[model samples]
Each structure stands twice: as C-alpha cells, then as structure tokens.
Target: MTTFRASGPPPAADPAVVVVTDLIVFAKHLRLLDAARLRGVTPLFVFGPETAGRDLARHRADPDHPLSRVPDGDVVHVPDTSLETLLRGVAPWLRERRVRAVLNVGEVFVEAAGALAQSLGLPGPGTHAAQVCRNKLLQRLAAPALAPRWTVLGADRAGDAERFGAYPAVLKPASRMSSSGVRAVAGPADVVPLLPEYGPGELVLLEERITGREYSVESLVRDGVVLWAGITAKDTNEADTAFFTETGHTSPAPHLTPAQEALLLDANSAFLGAVRFGTGMSHTEFRLTGGDRVVLMEAAARPPGDAITRLWRLATGMDQDAALLDLALGTDPVTAPPRRRARQVYLDHPRGLLTDVRADDVPVHWVGERGRWPDLPPAAADAPSRGHAVLVSRSRGDLLGDQADSRGRSVSVVLDGPLGADLDAVARDAARAVTISAVPLTPAGRTGEAVR
Candidate 1:
C-alpha cells in the first residue's frame, strides 16, 4: 500500500527539482530536500510504492524532518514499479510543476529517474547507463579492462563453474543489493547447493575473487567529467566467512601512493564512461591487488549509502548530498580538501537473544544517543550493526585496520587526533574497552529448557 502526505501548505507554483526515493529511504535523502530548500529550491518528492511506512512515520514524527517543513503539495506517491508506468504517472505532474531536475536518491528509482530525466530533457545518465549500473553482470561487461573475469550461469549450471578454473570465486545475484545472496564459494559442491536459493528465472554470476584491500571511489561527475574523487577504505566480514557484510570505512584512505590514486581515478573514469554515466555522483568500488592492480567490483549512479555522505562532510568538508542536489539542479558542486580524517566502525555481536553492552572505556561519540540499548534478535547471516561511532581525527594514522571480529560487532567508536597519532591503536583500545555479552540460544528441541 502507498500513501501521500500533501496536507501541509501548498508548494510554490513551480518547483526547482524532483527527488524520487525508493523503499529503503535514507536519512540523507531527507537532508537533501532540506538543503535544497535552504538554497531557495522548492523540492518535490515522489515515493515508491514499496516505500516503508516506518520511514515515513519517522519523518513525520520528527519535527526536524524536511518533509514536515516542505509544502504538502510537494509530496506524491507513485504506486508503480515499471519504469514506463512511473514515467507516465510522474511526467505530467512534473511538467505541471515545471521541475528543472530529477534526482534518484536510492537504487530502486535509478532507472526510472533516468527515464524521467530523459523525457524531460534534463541532465542524467540515460536509461541504458542506469540499467548497466544496476546489474553486476552488465557492469562487469561494460568495463572488461577493470572488471574481474566473470560468467553468467543458469541455476542448474554448476558443472560449468570449472571453466573459471578458480577455487575461491564469488557467486552473487546479478541485480540484488546490500550484499544479499552474495557468497564466496570454495568449490563446485559449494556452488551447486547455493544456486537453488535464487529464483528460477534469475541469472547468477560467477567471478574471480580479487584478493586485496578493498576501497570505494566516490566522485561527482559533470558532463562526463569527474569533478572530484575521494577514496574510502573499507572493511568487510572476516576473510573466512561467506558473509560479506561491510563492517567499517574510513575516508581519504589512510595511505595511497600517487600511482595507486592515479590508477583508481583512471579506472573509475573509464568505468563511468564505459557505462555512459553522464552526470551526478558516482560510487564505484574496486579491489587493489598485490601488484597495485585495480579491479572494478561495482558502480552505482547515486550517492553511496551506509553513512558515507555524512562521513564525507566530516572528513573532507564536502556535503555530498548537497552536491548531488546541486548537480541535479544543473549547478556546479563546491568541494574542499580534507580538513580532518573520519572513521566509522560498526558494532557486531554473536548469535543470541538479550544482550548487554559496555563502552565505558571507548573515547568516542556514539551515533545514536542512548543510555541503554534494547535486546536484539538472534544474530542471523544478515545481522546489521547495532550502531556506530563517528570519529574525527587530525591524523590519518589514528584510523586503520579492522577493529571488529566475525563473532559480531555491536559498538563503534569515533575519535580525532593529530596527523601522526596512532588511530589504529586507539581503535584497538576502544574495541578492547567495549564488550557485547549475549546468552547463547538453546538448541531447537530445547524450547522448554531453563536458562543456564
């Protein structure tokens, strides 16, 4: 079911931009509207059919939410998933409002946003580019020079895995997000059993797993030119696990030689052009191999998720959300060099019921202001971090390496210090100071058993 909130004051006769958001709306998206309003742009928002009610409720409940302040007439709900349907429903409304630009704030709306922009003759990556960015197989094929060798296989084609001649290959859905159903398989036996998890008509991809440090290149592209690029250091689940959950990230990736930086820029540029990404912000992830080789993993036409937009502002004084808004409105983005380094470490915990958390020794600000946390469900394969801490450090060295373990992280600490400070040691010390205690769940048959 879908709902629209156009109960507030009427919007300007003509708005400057339209932002189409998906089911998984992020807080930054709301902030984008607020920033545009601050800049005298009357922004209109179109929500997807599957847009979460909880998200909308949260926004409406929060007095500071941009939606609460924006004109009621600016909010619209489009209950359609098909690009043609969405375009047809929204095109007339946009034309009536005279919106100058369109912004796709989430993955679900990328293709639709592109189609709508093209229909309106606005600046955007065309539908073809947006479609390529959404599908992993297409992204790899578009940039063969930078992507790892990969092949598309049917659900019943496990025997064909031998063609890759690789043991530790990655198998993933071609078009899923949030690393769902993405697994690193060691052998054909492992690959065959996992294939059935995908739907009958869905295609799966088997690709060589590039072993190296992982990083993401974030850029603002204008007219096919990259205006500014930033490198983010990434930490994922432990190497031995099949789960590829992202655990942490640091901006301005601590130490990158000039050659490595150039390689990332060159590869990113090539990949974006190959996909025909023309404008707006781009988030492209790559793996840096032992020989300084850069291999593309994936690219998205929209801004990055997982608090990257907030980190960029803290670390580099760049408001990526606002910059993307400006790009959508045909304005040049204003960017600045890093004034401080920022790091976000996710909290993980083991499988259990109620949990106790201790963070008395960690010297950092927690993301959510809470004195005590509620009990969490038993940790599943897709267990998300409880919360994270934001740290601003003067020294890049202070933030390095993976601080959380596979057992599960539950707390993140942020800190800031001088240029030569040991952020790594600080993070380790913070991790040591914080501990998550959970009582393990009993076996399936022991439902009546008492707590030990």
Candidate 2:
C-alpha cells in the first residue's frame, strides 16, 4: 500500500527545485540544502516511507533538527517512491510553484527522478542515462569496451551461476547500492551458495575480477559537457575476505602519474559519452589493471557518497554542491584547481553490541555547517588550514554485524592536509586517535566485558 501526504500551506511563486531523495543525513548532505537556499531556490523534498516514517517523525518533533529549516509545504512524504506515485504527488507542487528543475540525490530512485524531470520539461540526466547508471548489467552492455569481461544471470536462470566458469570473479546485484550483496568469489563453489541470498527475481552479474588499484571519478556536466572531474583513490576491506566494502577514500588521489591520471580521465569521459549523460553530477568507479587499463566497475548519476564531496572541497576548494545546483539550473558549473589533499578513513570495530564510540581528544575541525552555511569556507579566506573530524554512524546497543558490506561499518574519520603531506600517515594517525567499545555476545547468549 502507498500513501501520499502533503500538509501545511501551498508553496509560494518563487522558483523551486524538487529533490528526490531518501533519508536526510545532515553530516553528509547539508551542503545540498544550503546550496538551494543560497541560490534563492525553494527546495521541495520528496521522501519515501523509509525516510518519511520514523526519521521524519523524529525530525518534526525536534525543533533543532535541520528539517525544521525547511518549510512544511516543501516536505512531501509518500509511502512509495515509484515514478507514477512521485509524479502524482508532485503534480500539485508543480502547479502551485514555479519549478525550474528536479534533482536526484539517492541512487535507487535516479531513474524515477530523471523521468519526473523529463515529464515536466526540466533539466536532468534523462531516462536513458539514468537507466544505464542504475543497472550494472546495462552499464556493462552499453560500454563493453570500458568494462571487464562479464556475464549475466536472469532471475529465472540464476541457478546456473557456475556455468560462467570464471574464477576469482565478482558477484553483484544488477541494481543495488552501498556495495550491498557485492562479493568476491573464488570459484563456482563459492558462487552457488550465495545464490539463495539474493532476493527472489533479482538479476545478478558475475564478472572477471579486475585486479589493481580502485578509484572514483566525480564529474559535473552541463549540456553534455564535463565542466570538471576529480579523482578519488579508494580502498576496500580486503581483510573481510568476501565483500568489496569501501573503507577509505582520498581525493586528488596522491600517487597517480600524469599518464595514468590522463587515462582514467579519458575513460571517464568516454563512459559519460557512451551513456549520453545530459547534465548533473556523475560518480564513476574504476579499476586500473596491470597495464594501466581502466575498467569500469559502475557509475551513478549523482554526487559520490560517504563525504567524498567534503574531501573534494577541502582538497580543491571547489563547492561541488553549488556546482551541482548550477548544472540543474541549466548553467555551467564552476571549477577550481587542487590546492591540498583530503582523506576519509572508516575505522574498524569488533562485531558485538556497540557501547561507546568517540574521538573527543582529537583536535579535529569537522567540515559542513548547519547555520551560516552560505557563508562557510572555501568562500571564506579563514577556512581551517588543517582539519580532521570523526563521525559515528551506529548508536549504543546497536548490534554490529561482520563487515560484509558498507552498512556493517560503524564510524569514519576525515582529514585534510597540505598537498605534499603524507596522506597515508595522516590517515593512520586519524584512525588511531579514535576509541570504540563493544561488548561481545557468547554463543549461549552471555555478554562479555566491553572490549576497547
């Protein structure tokens, strides 16, 4: 069952941008809201039940919550985020307000949001690009030249996983995010058992694992032209032994040679061209093989998640949020040269019940702000010359699962330093600065002392 609820008064005649997204995490996405307000555009947020239910209720109850900054008419909660439902639910807003664009912030609903934008003759990535971006199989099919060797198994024929005969391969869902259900399989034996874990009637892809360094290229496009692209070096939890869960990221990737960086940029440009991406931001992941061969793992028609945008801002002094808004408003995006290095590392913790997590002793200056966001730096000359901060995702009493995927991880630390500084050392020091405590559970349901 789906429900659409639009409360409060009707919106004003000012130009508005409809943002199709899920939960609102201020720590990561406050720049988006700040950007809209700074640009004099009203933001109309369309949320699904997953966000609208508990999270929305909590935000509405708390007067200090960031959602309180937004007008009540601008927040529309729908039971489902399907395209038909969004169009119907948003029709009234479009009729009442002067809507100029529709932007997508969540990976799962990119296609629906693009279609919504197109239906109203607004700027967007378009359905074709969004569709290709959403489905891994479609991405592989559309750009075979850029992808690694791969094969697909339809929901009806998923039992034939072993038929591919590919060893040391990667098994991933056709349409999922956050590295969920993405695993590195050694052989057919490892592949068969995982088949039952997938949802019934879900498409899966098995591909030859391209070995080497992993990185992501984030670009802002306007009228099919890429205004700028930033490369972010990525590291995964290889010790987990199965899933490719990202653990760290460094923007303006430190060690890439000129030639290697050029190859990655060209491949990213080729991918954007192949998909015929019209406008907005793109986050594309790639694996650089032995001979500098760039293989596309996947791409999303949205800003890179996990505070990578913050890294970019600290590294290059570019306001990616404002750049994204510029593209949505049918204008060219602004760019800046790299001036520093920024890194984000997710800390490791034991599997048990989380008791305490803190980095209070670390002299860290966290990026992003709630108030005076429009006046915050890069724009300000006195922006912190060096910065570091910690973010804890899980709360006390939360049961911590094995690090099989991104959701299993609990906390992360972000650091900023000079361009020539050792990012590796900076990352290591940041990790050691934090402290976590978890109480392990015994097989017979007994709880052990808190382990720090």
Q: Evaluated with lDDT, which candidate comes out highest?
A: 2
Among residues 3 or more apart in sequence or in different chains, the pairs in candidate 2 whose N, CA or C atoms overlap within 3 Å are none
Q: How high is the lDDT of residue 243 in model 1?
A: 69
Where does model 1 exceed 4 Å of error? 1-12, 88-92, 353-419, 432-452
lDDT tens per residue, model 2, 146-255: 98888886654445665776668888898988899998888777887788888777888889988899999999887778889989999998655788999999988978
TM-score, each model?
0.81, 0.90
Model 1 agreement with the true structure over 22-56: per-residue lDDT tens digits: 53444445557557867777777777776655656
Query: Residue 382 in model 1: shift from native, Å?
Result: 38
The superposed Cα distance between candidate 1 and the true structure at residue 5, in angstroms, equals: 23
